[model samples]
Target: PLTVLQGYLEMMQEQVLEGATREKALHTMREQTQRMEGLVKQLLTLSRIEAAPALAMNDRIDVPMMLRVVEREAQTLSQEKQTLIFTVDEQLKVLGNEEQLRSAISNLVYNAVNHTSPGTEIRVSWQRTPQGALFSVEDNGPGIAP
Candidate 1:
């Protein structure tokens, strides 16, 4: 994101981006700046989570609603390059730190989008199991290297 912002700053500094081109550059810069801010917040949340082993898992989070928000964010971030499929069980709910869970899920979706090619299909799902609830993010992206 910083790289993106830096590139845009350089472009703006070097030449006068005009009309639609300037608008597009400004829009992209804003998005990247927002992404960077989100990253910083996530890092701070992660640090806090690490320092305190037990995050308050008392809130009853609406899993489906949260997933929907995540889906929307992923769509914006991926800019329609990837096909996003969400299969969420409407009744599924979870007990956890809402912020943490949201952050984790967002990270998973963003990671998939970032790692995959433009045409890759990413699937996110949340369902109920006999023992508990299950959440997953899967994609037709390359496997991690050993």
Candidate 2:
């Protein structure tokens, strides 16, 4: 994006493009700047979140219900490109920060859905484990080993 911005600026300086071309370049540069700003803000937020203390919201987390809502929200993320599904063996509850858990799982769903091809199916499921509980987001998207 920086390279493209530089090219546009050089073109504008050289008078190689004018009027509508100049407007388009300016708009593109604005968009690139906004995108960069957004990315920087996101990185800062992530840093802050990581540096914070461990989660202390000792509230009951209804796993199934939360996953269902996350699935609904995630559907809008991929829209026509992906399908989101949630499955649970039964109602399972845990204690944690509901907002934190939902955000973490929703991020996984988005990660799976966004990376997969059109018409891909993404599955979000949870089950009881010997240790406690397990949550997973499964997708046909090319993974690290791909």
RMSD of each: 4.9, 3.7
Estimate TM-scores for all models. 0.68, 0.71
Question: Can you list the residue pairs that collide in candidate 1?
Answer: none
> In model 1, where is the ten-residue run with the lowest total lDDT?
137-146
**What is the C-alpha lDDT profile of model 2 across 1-146, one tens digit per residue?**
67777888888788776788778888999988876775686587678779989878789888788877777778777776887777786678889888778767776777687679998788778988899898988888876353
lDDT of 1: 0.89
| Candidate 2 deviant stretches above 4 angstroms | 1-38, 142-146
lDDT, residue 84, model 1: 94
Clashing pairs in 2: none
Measured with C-alpha atoms, the lDDT of residue 87 in candidate 1 is 95
Candidate 1 lDDT over residue span 25-81, tens digit each: 999999999889877987997788899878679999998999988889899999999
What ranges in model 1 sit over 4 Å off? 1-44, 143-146
**How far does residue 19 in candidate 2 sit from its true spot (Å)?**
10
